[model samples]
Target: MKRTLVVGVDGSPESRAAADWAAREAVRRDLPLRVVHAWLWQPLAYPLAQNRDAEARLAEDILKETEGDLSHRYPGLTLTAEVLAELPVPALLRAAEDAEMLALGTRGHGALAGFLLGSYGQQVIAAAKCPVVSVRSAHGRPVALPEQGEVVVGQQGGVADSSEVLRFAFEAAAAADAPLRAVRAWNSPPVYGYSLGPMWSADQFGGLEPYEKAALEQALEPWRLKYPEVEVVEHVEQGGGGHVLLTAASDARLLVVGRRVRESSVGVRVGSVAHAVLHHSVCPVAVVPHP
Candidate 1:
């Protein structure tokens, strides 16, 4: 069976926006969409607890409401809804195992707000097997993916670390018929520490922007060949990665970034760039895990 696109909803405005975004993505990918809600049972004695059946009914109601809205919006789109009797993190991760991608609602405030505010969202994104898209609403409504604005993706390191990010960005741009903006940021080398013989050429003493731009183009050449139809705009700037990506994606419909999958006894790491963009990006952000 084909993997479906899964989206988690808790009836918040941000979640509703995610559902809207996911539905459109499903249409674009020609994939089935699954709308899910995790319903963890709490004891009746708990302060905010209701009866078990009432809680279950409420969970089902949330799914029903979202399903109804999305079904009405996309008449021909294949959609399904379910309520999982488990906690949010594991439940969504399990659902994502068989999914093409997972979409979640995120707030556009400080680093500690929305689904991403705590460990819940972080856990799901770090541990999931597929790409996770975090979406935010604008002015109390879902921001529609722009047709003209480019689909921006941050490229770092090399093709090995950023292949998945580039692939997702190219496919998204192709699907939306929009341009793809590939951004690479760099910082100048320290003035005193280095031998200039091997690292710097005679002409490079003046500046390194040309070399940085060339490296960026080299990293993107293969992708450009593969996606010949995608109009790619290469952007190389001198600054921090997160700041440069956010600025380049200011008018973007979607921002794609790579998260290196790391296993640690302490916890999963979302990386500095991904973390920064997740906290502040104005458009929807997709975190693609890569080696």
Candidate 2:
């Protein structure tokens, strides 16, 4: 179980793009790359000739093609390809259990439009043992990352559980030599109003904004000191966390979100904000599970 970056590929343009992203990421981390494709055999009612053989060949073909292209593109990089006879979610989860990070395509072949990430991709993201990054096809974004693009992360008021997410974002920014934007979203309590006048006007916020700004700064202070070379930007906005993070990540290189682990739950526990961003982020999205 040597450290490696695992990518799920299925011969689609989106998966290929994810593989490309993972290759570059592997190079960045100086780790080996593992490309995996999952295939399950379905038993026909009458069982004429089994298509299992053909499907297995196809899976091998996809794996080999990906391995060849990646090897050529990233010379001197260690890469392995595997075709697992298991369902996509379980297969990917197992492969990623020992990986530094798992990279997945936003959608698969014959994906329905309007869904930011396909169903299979979502399941894997919700269950992966390591950090999972959802990457879109090259055409999903412009050829060049936007000039204002940075590694944006949702700061959960600098909670102890969010340190992993913030650290991941800062490291990514440092790797890209880009800035890290920490966004903290807050909402003020609503006040009952009368027809004559509106209740709880802007003045009622009463230093709440400053308090949020201070909290954001305090959460980021240690990260800033540790990664002094990485420029840090703090944004405290008034709105739902999901919307704030989505808007800020529009031009970002990567959006990192944290998932708090709940022992009472049977599987990984993903919050509403993390779920929202996973379904709508324009750039690559990373989900880091934290206790």
Each prediction's RMSD over C-alphas, in Å, is: 3.6, 5.3
Model 1 lDDT vs. the true structure? 0.83
lDDT per residue, candidate 1, 13-123, as tens digits?
778888989999999988999998887765755476356776677678878999999999999899999988777888999999989899988742321123323357778
RMSD of 1: 3.6
TM-score, every prediction: 0.89, 0.84
Q: Looking at candidate 1, what is the lDDT of residue 139?
A: 67
lDDT of residue 107 for candidate 1: 45
Where does candidate 2 stray beyond 4 Å?
Answer: 46-49, 110-117, 137-148, 191-206, 263-269
Task: Give one digit per residue, the lDDT tens place, for model 2 in 140-164.
Answer: 5413323357989998845575788
Poorest lDDT segment (10 consecutive residues) of candidate 2:
193-202
Runs of candidate 1 exceeding 4 Å displacement: 44-49, 108-118, 137-147, 191-207
